[model samples]
Target: MGLFEKLFPRRPPDADPRAYFKTLTAYQPVYTTYRGGLYEMALTRAAIAAFARHCSKLHLEIVGDFRPELAPVLGQQPNPWMDASKFIARLATIYQVQNNAFIVPVEDAAGRLVGYYPVLPQQTSIREYGGAPYLQYEFWGGQRAAVELSRAGLLTQHQYEDDFFGADNRPMLPTLQVMRTQDEGIVNGIKNATTIRFLARLAANLKQKDIDAERKRFAKDNLEGNNTGVMMFDSKYADVKQIESTALVVNPKQQELIRESVFEYFGTNEKILTNTYTEDEWNAYYEGSIEPFAIQLSLVLTAMTFTPAEIAQGAGIIATANRLQYASNNTKLNIVTQLFDRGFLTHNMGLEIFNMPPVEDGDKYYIRKEYAEVSKLNTETDPTGTTEPKEGDNGDHTGDP
Candidate 1:
């Protein structure tokens, strides 16, 4: 037996590729003090929520003369199970949490591509054999299956030593820890402030049993909100005070600091979370965060879905966000008008920019009559030394005279 076979026993050809022996199973990740698993990390850290929301809202589109039949499947809806937006949202969450997203293509019996199904990063494993990596998928707690990379689609924003997987956001451990601590402190402080405490004083001559009875009576009567007033003898004294908490005041500063850090880590700003960004800031944010992801997703989708010949024939995929989403109506109108007036954009193209159907002769480019070449302008001026009207000016003089 070869070394590859020795390391991983080969499965029977007829056996289901999704089934694997227990011995071949890989180790699962455990929650750590600094970070938890995918779901836990998202739940505990506010940064993940911001990242997911920001990425999910950004639109995704495929741009290219690609397969017409595959458009509905890949562009409009990734699968019958979910629409394109939902699929992208799920993919974005997976990418942010694990830094890698894997999709399995579902094909019909005729071998035509139908839909794509996303697999959780934690539920999948990568194994190397004969110097190449193979993906292993696990489900229902123990069932394992191996899939070839060609059959599976993968998207990764950051590359790592392991070719099969991407680098995770584990480096943010310290920041996450600080944020977690701040959150816990704020929660504890709020709890303390909401709690009620009592101070009681008893007469020195009072018996121990009488003191105990008084304490019990105070607890039974004063603890509940129903007892607003309490009757006490001269020997017994009690006062109820609400715990003064600094959390309401102190936590805001810490919370703001944490929010800034979280937004910075995700390459977004507070305006995005607050929905208060100006037009210019929103454009910059889209360029920095949303555009890159869309481009990467387009490249991966094209490569996985199209053949070399098809790609060579101008067949590819591209993800584009709606311009209206980032820019206001006035901004879009100005841009389109400027480009069109300068002859940089044709009428049809301008119409397309507004998502309107092109009309006849819309492909023609027009320039303003006042914009003439410098040489043409020079020719139009009089070359004579004196600026005097010559004979036949305006063709009113008669040559016969």
Candidate 2:
């Protein structure tokens, strides 16, 4: 080993006792929306109930259909052919504003709501296939009209939502018309899309489960649902192409792990750990390690966990560094050196105030530059009026601002 390497050989201290149990085990939040317009949509009453059963076993909250009023709203105007398209557009507007519906709080074994998934109705077709895209009706005029008007109107154009102030934060789904046109015979395309999105969201929420229990539930739920002949398929030139379909969307076990981890991070309350740290420390950690690790680990974990990982990963790092700084044998220089030498610690992991990872030759880690100039704005000395007693001014205080 080189002199610098040997001199700075990393040591394994008791990595905070809290960290041993923080193995990405928390449940993340997820939601699923189903469309029931099609007779053969996979999200049948029985299917949804079965999916809910599996979700319960994995600590995932199940959100059923939100668009139950679709038919009522569309059929309200007494025009199924022309006004139907306009009605679908209005539904899209409502969906864009509210973003989600039917928020289900996923609980841990202790019945604490760690994360939430909100189910919505499949209001738009996400499927783009063949010469005639399934969701094409909303974007352009269907067979009767030459130009595809906005689903609702020009005011609520889908492209308008593609801006910085747009509703991309809101999720979307396929409208019944889009689904019907995409798949002839009104195949359960809406239900399938809703189910797929829900599963994807669920997979992005929790991880780690009681493997045996999860597997058993998976098998049971798969069999419990009727065949129903609801299949996920791709349409090619008006030809039906069946895609592989599974009863369960995500691995129940991985989701359990992520959910467990998030729960631990959130503790019993629904609050994230970001509020637990002092503001300065919070800024330092976020700008340094928290954001980086959260981005990196999201690859292995779910979106639900990504939220907490961004909040909690810094906990262990901060605690470790604090403990080392307190030990007499460990100084700031030594701590920074050991931290850098650790294989898992990335340069951008926020190791500053000591020997930070050298800035790359042509990289822009910071653009505003003012962050570096942030003087320690001591709250103790700010002009909130002296918290400490002033000379002879506090005993007989007269109130005046």
Candidate 3:
């Protein structure tokens, strides 16, 4: 080797663990997502669950021969214990909640791929062992496991600063704070609405203990048990004034904006969560949210499952969602009526659009043959399959019979 090449030889990617997992100083918080569970917010949690459920409806399939076992395994159940939909939903939820997710393959005793599982580690650290990268998982139950990086598919969003992992939800803290404050204000308002409060002038010579006793006596007599809606005041007070308790009047517009900010962050809205989105809205959501997820997962799983050569040979995985499934009944009817006879879709497929069970012979494709090809309408070429124009007939036949 040349002297320069020998002296400055590049190290492999797994040479150092710190390269991917940055070491934080003592003042900085430890590795955690959303600053240690901001998703506990009801709105955020609901949005994540709804978004995940929507995405998990999509299908994941293996496209090539590199991993034939995955095709069947991904169809309905990825593992013996978990259904495919549940697996995908949990994966999506973890990825959203933590800003990162890891998918590791499960193998049988024979070393054959049996299933796939998404791991949620309370703490994740990268380690280098024998010149290879490994992910160390620390579970909340005090259980731990290690897996080679190559065997796991890592998916992350909002990724920046860190090399492999995604950034935390610190940027979203302000929005969540608004939501949190608004909720608390509403709760406080609801409580204050039903209670009657008053301020009254008391006798000047009354001691603190006497005043406390008087207040307790008033509460017990007027507010504790069921009684007529009336209060009798003694002459000890020079003035008595009832305080009007108004419910928390949060700015409706400000609250809407905050909700919109959260919805935008999570790629969802009230309509999306409630499943009232129109066809166009659903399509937009699918394109903006689900499609990118599908693409990333496809790539991540493809890489995790195949070698470079295998990928080059057209072996890969694909995840897809049927946005049309969310179309309105009228739109679905139109689609079925328009495309069914064109042979672009089969009878069973059209039925699927309506969520109906397939009938006998539904697999058959029926294409209309009543219409003939333009060239085959030629008067000069009856019973001949040739579509070529005649040499003299190339000129426009302007004669009008």
- Name the top lDDT candidate: 3
Tens-place lDDT digits, model 2, residues 119-220: 233232222222221211111221211111111111121224222112322222333233334344224544565443212112222335753454345435
Whole-model lDDT values for every prediction: 0.62, 0.29, 0.76
TM-score of each: 0.70, 0.16, 0.81
Ranking by TM-score: 3, 1, 2
lDDT of 3 by residue, 146-191 (tens): 6677877889998766666777777678887877888898998879
- Model 3 alpha-carbon drift over 4 Å, by segment: 1-35, 189-196, 218-230, 370-401
| Backbone clashes in model 3 | 0
TM-score of 2: 0.16
Expressed as tens digits, the lDDT of each residue in 52-88 for candidate 1 is: 5666654444445666777767667777667877788
Residue 2 in model 1: lDDT? 36
